[model samples]
Target: MSFDGRLLSGISVLAAVVQSRNFARAADVLGITASGVSRAIGRLEERVGVRLLDRTTRSMVLTDEGRLFYEQVAPLLFGIEEAAVSASGAGGVARGRLRVDIDPYFLRSQLSGRLGGFLRAHPELTLELVTRDHVGDLVTDGIDVAVRFGEPVVASAIARKLMETRVLTVASPGYLKKHGRPVHPSDIAGHHCIQFFDPVTRRPFDWEFHRGRKVLPVATLSRLYVSDVGTMVNECLAGTGIAQVLAIRIQPLLESGRLIDLFPDWSGETFPLYALYPSRNHQPAKVRAFVDFVSKVIREPPAHR
Candidate 1:
């Protein structure tokens, strides 16, 4: 029997089941149903004219012939994956599911509205956006790319600096009008400051201010504290209090006059945003496409411009 496309597909399914040691685990990785995996394996066994697996109710074992076949097939499958990625990246037609882990604040402010445009640009691509306050283990999470605020600490992955984003101290115009505006960072102590806490640290983030060469970290007293960035924006808009947040998200509000910059002269703290992936050696087309798209978005000015 000549090796054709159907045989190759069967071999791939068999290899996944053997490597994962379970149909369910293999299905998860392949993004297929467990029954589909079982059917594929059954077809493969029939085509090969051998019972590759010694199947019991509780578990399965690769037969001697199956073991030999697996040893030969697994490497070829991996090579195929590498080749596919290389071709896809070079062809610039990004397809397949692009799983991304993002900082929640960044999502709320920067990417939420703009995601639809990216998907429309590449109709063959599917996007999975996972957001949280704390950084997760990329391998365990099956994340293709991770977008994070501040510097990344993943030594194994390739980290690309997307941008250095400034932190802005801002308040709603109504809130500022009612409570009055502060000219200096020190003057914020008298206002109702809405605070955000780091998810991993569980401590309030200190407001950062820059004046010439000196960087100042101020711990302002706050009656309102929130864990989510969206909530902080809402509270500020509702005239609940002043908030210090990333400037990227608040640019529209700033331009529309919904929020007023608290200390423009002292805005100095810049945080690094990183796009992280498994390795730089053979980056997947979907991941590379997403990184390039996001970089373009960040570099472009707000709609007001």
Candidate 2:
């Protein structure tokens, strides 16, 4: 079949239909009527000489040929769209809404305090920041960028290391005054500890510590358990118990003498921070801007807390 001017439009509509799972939805995305979307797909199918969709009154599914075509064409379409965005307006300013899914703790500790600078730097851009303790499916959630703790696992997205925050054992001055400071990791077992439950694993996270070559998770018992990072911070602030937390989150408190680091020599483990995005090839300018800003902010020690 001879290529024509309508080829790109037809392929785009077909891809959008598959992505939206309905012609009406695809039309909404493409800023056209549902009938127009149907015609675009039909014209493309006629041109290609194969059925692209299995349609019913209520729903439609991709045929084998359509699936193969979509799989090959979707990435190219994404590249084209991104290229247009990159070249649009004067000097190609990054002007768009950035959907960011961030770790709740990281948001509270690092981003919430430093966002003003980023927003001022890119006034044309808007930000939608969603905070969650557990990472969700990025594509399904429509997340443009995700900042998460731990190693990156998503194969489809590019993960950039932002920085590492030390895992620290900390306590309020009042709590330490009352219970006495624990000099060794072993002493933690006898003290009242506030434990944070892992939302994903459904168990209290083990307190990991190290001194020299000896690194281990201290299985200390706790009567208080919290699932949320904010709650854990509050509990520690209230002088209820000693807690293991990310040092960056409690830096201000430590500096202000509201909290004191406990077993400093033993508490040396660091957790990696990562920024994940859909594609390296055609990353939106807005996504690139946000990622760069966040990396800069988190990497600076003074921005934390």
Candidate 3:
């Protein structure tokens, strides 16, 4: 095959594979079968006269040659996209797909209702909100942006601090009424405490508390353990046990008198919530617009009561 033809096919197949991460997913994205994707990749490798990917039944990883090829071509492809956008005057408008990954609990409490205004602001933009507890890779996964808790560990990504999340110990009013509110951190050892299990660490999180210039760790007496923060909040609301959760997650329940804050004077460590992307240099206009909108929302007061 000619160089042009080989390059064209390679770029397409490479992009599909990188975006999807699996032959089946790539096939779905490209409107083809898994066998078709495999065939295309095979042809691409034959044309280039080099193996591009290391594949197994479970996973597909790129070879050194494939990585170099992708690094060189990705920018060119993005440049072409940017040129098209400029020629079409799309840069002046917010349009096209805006893909974002966010924590499920944060999205439910903070972004669910407020997204309407963002959509209204950019009428032409199509938004895809992916709610997952697992951290997503922005580049290979084709995510335009992500709203996540904590600082970005990846050096390649650009992170902007959106807000500081405050953790609180709370329980349903009925639970407190029945079991009595704990006056000290040691008091929690006797109470039924709802624990969030860290999936990566395989350990239940202990409750954190501050005592005037000293931080104290309250070892959780977990009667019920859960992975989902939303479920934990609901369990607390059902009068199951005291839960240590992000303050924003339980704000509605607190305001509605369904839940009461325990150890009101004690505050846990505050962590930064960040908006992250694959760096600012030559960022997509759609991504820039979405990030700016999200930053604005973060700066503003909570829309919910």
Instruction: Work out the TM-score per prediction.
Output: 0.74, 0.79, 0.81
lDDT string, candidate 3, 1-305, tens digits: 54586668668877778767889888888898888888889988887788888998777877878766665677677777788888987766778777788888878776777788888988999999888766655666667788887667656577878788778888888898899989987799899989998755668876778756779887767779888998998888899999888776676677778888777788756768888876435778777787787666666655432
Comparing 1 and 2 by TM-score, which wins?
2
Q: Write the per-residue lDDT of candidate 2 for residues 1-305, one digit (tens) a residue.
A: 78567989898888677656688888898999999998998999998999989988688888878766765676687787776765765334667667898988778777786788888988998888988777765553457789888787666677888888888898898898888988888888899999888777788877878777889767787899888888988889999998988877788888888888887788668888898875535567788888888777766766343
Q: Candidate 1's error at 172, in angstroms? A: 1.5
Looking at model 2, report the run of 10 residues with the lowest lDDT sum. Answer: 85-94
**Any idea what lDDT model 1 has?**
0.80
Q: In angstroms, give how far residue 234 of model 1 lies from its true place.
A: 0.8
> TM-score of the candidate numbered 2?
0.79
Model 1 regions lying over 4 Å from their true place? 1-25, 28-79, 85-91
Q: Is candidate 2 or 3 superior in lDDT?
A: 2
Clash pairs for candidate 1? none
Order the candidates by TM-score, highest first — what do you get?
Answer: 3, 2, 1
Worst 10 residues of 3 by lDDT: 296-305
lDDT of 1 by residue, 83-111 (tens): 87666664557787777998877776667
